[model samples]
Target: MKLSDRQEKIIDLVRVGQPVTSVALADKLGVTRAALRADLAILTMIGTLDARPKVGYVYSDKPKRNLLLDYISDIKVSEIMSKPAVISESTMVYDAIVYLFLNDVGTVFVENNGNLVGAASRKDFLKISIGGTDIHKVPVGIIMTRMPNIICGRADDSAYEIASKIIEHEIDSIPIVETLKVDGDKEQYKIIGKVSKTNITKLFVKMGKSK
Candidate 1:
């Protein structure tokens, strides 16, 4: 949820001070108590502040920690995923190399008919290139590791789950995908985005700095 300037200031004030009374807060903020009612109510309802009949508003440690954990675990892949590097399944290995370098991504999703068919990584391209073959003529589909064999994540999957998949598979990234049914019950997935180890690290750093 987007927070207004006053709401953000309220949070900062509560964080740095002890429980504060509405009168004192309003005086300090140069606003009337009535003006703060909605802000305080929203903060309390959202578990950001604890209010008592006479004790005023306080930031509860336990609730704040729980909120942080919930935020991390409930974060969807779509929230943190980056635009996926993609190539047509029919793209030549030579062209794929050029695209990969231009995009500066370790892996690229290979698509056919709008469906994710496979993936090619820098390692995959290097392996073929080292063989002294005519990569310029070889379709990436022939060298890519196909679906069902590729590890992937869903767009709605939690970021925590995506991070786990990356570690468990020992891969640099996982494609965020959506499942589609085709051909009388056969299912295929379309690539939407990518979650990488770097993304997880950035999350960790952000959480740490906030704490």
Candidate 2:
């Protein structure tokens, strides 16, 4: 879409000197932190923004910028992991393929009794398809990588750590996970949002145009 005048202004400022804190920029813009946050969220959703700790918001003008390394270092997996799309062990290969394609997502989380069990990716679907297995007869459990040493991140940690791990491990995604606390609080982890190539690409485009 269309960006408003203020949004365009924000882009210009970020392009010149990113790694700037929201507080600093917000003050200059004469807007409340809350209002600025709302605007940032809007820009981010449309792939025009990114944020990190110690370096505030970043407008990536470099197309090849290592956002995962340069900016996401302060972010946690919980902050950027997209909502989990769960499938049972019994889910059919045919149906799984449909789900992945329909959602335009690269992978889906396999769950059993609300606990993460495994992961299935587009590559898995392709493999299955090539195996000549009966898509309808086979269950996802038959082919999915079982207990694939899931990579996870906690909400309390910095996103930078999460991004670093992703790059180091050569993995594209991480599941945000949490355990219970001593105070009888139900420890829950819901993938809040996702940070991927898509997120980085949006930031690059927005910053490039701004410059």
Candidate 3:
């Protein structure tokens, strides 16, 4: 969910060690405590605000700015990335279907031996299911598009780079594949997170404020 100007102010206020009580938030936002509570609920649901007893909401620890933002704004992949939706290559199509529906996300990354191997979109699963294929019998690997050609991202990559890739490739999300070095050997790729269009949109909102 996109945050509003008031919501951003609330987050900033909370970050600066200000009281985030609904009454305080309401006063700052020029809204009723009831309205501020509603706003806080949304932020809490999206993992932005911490729920407390009477102390009210608190912002999650703010991320530190880097050299990238010296040229750009306060936008980073951490601020924009979505909770990863990863599955093993051996995952059943039925499982993928359930995850997609439950998470309301359209794509899932496929892992093999703890490394990224492929990705499957909702369209891939839908096409197979619609073609009368038994989901329980279909491994996601059968329909997944493999890596090497797949687009990916690094965790520390700037939001601008992520956004550019999303626009350039016309993809819904980008997997954040971390490199694993075993026994001091060469780095191998493994997906650890994911960033999506929705995430980029949030970054845009945050950057708009910093400007």
Candidate 4:
């Protein structure tokens, strides 16, 4: 959400001149009109400036909300989440890695009896691969980071919160889960979908294209 110095300057010029044309702003800033296009578009997208037909750029007195953040915070996980790649916990690491490649995913969720139990990443597979362990005999269940320890998200969770968890946990993806049954202190969850780094990046890219 940090604006560059040039972007700050562009805001200042538009504010002082009020309804300044892109051509005038570019001239004052000693840049071409094309160079100002991106900045102007970003300002307008962020609610910092308003563009009027037949007019020019004028500062928007409305609340300056970071539109990207606004979109993320308001967006639900189910809106952007992709179908998660899943494998049985008993699947061999070698087979799991192959499945991971076939599905084009960085992480794979491991389930037992249709309940989410664990997750494993490419890094984990690679680590085991080079360790001289017989991957064919090494089940994903043993290598996978088990549930209650793995971070998870709900269908109703905000995309922003899930994205933050991805950063905070230093993981590639989060499994979106639904509570199934409670066994005393233990709870079972069914994997529904997942939100990954690629999803968040695409969301940002789409939001950035806003007018």
What do the candidate models score in CA lDDT, each in turn? 0.88, 0.68, 0.79, 0.91
Question: CA lDDT of 31 in candidate 3?
Answer: 84
Best by TM-score: 4
Span of ten consecutive residues with least summed lDDT in model 3 = 62-71
Model 1 regions more than 4 Å off: 1-71
Higher-TM-score candidate of 3 and 4:
4
State residue 137's C-alpha deviation in candidate 1, in Å: 1.6
Can you list the residue pairs that collide in candidate 3? none
| Per-candidate total of colliding backbone pairs | 0, 16, 0, 0
How well does candidate 1 match the true structure in TM-score terms? 0.65
Candidate 2 wrongly placed segments (more than 4 Å): 1-72, 180-195, 200-211
Each prediction's TM-score against the native?
0.65, 0.54, 0.61, 0.69
- Segments in model 4 whose C-alpha atoms lie over 4 Å from true places: 1-63, 66-68, 182-186
- Encode model 3's per-residue lDDT on 70-184: one tens digit a residue: 6454456766677778888888999988988888887988887788889888778878988988899889998898978789998788888887898999888899978899769
For residue 168, model 3's alpha carbon misses the true position, in angstroms, by: 1.2
Measured with C-alpha atoms, the lDDT of residue 159 in candidate 1 is 88
- For model 2 the TM-score comes to 0.54
lDDT of 2 by residue, 9-66 (tens): 8888887878678887788899888888877877665556677767788875443235
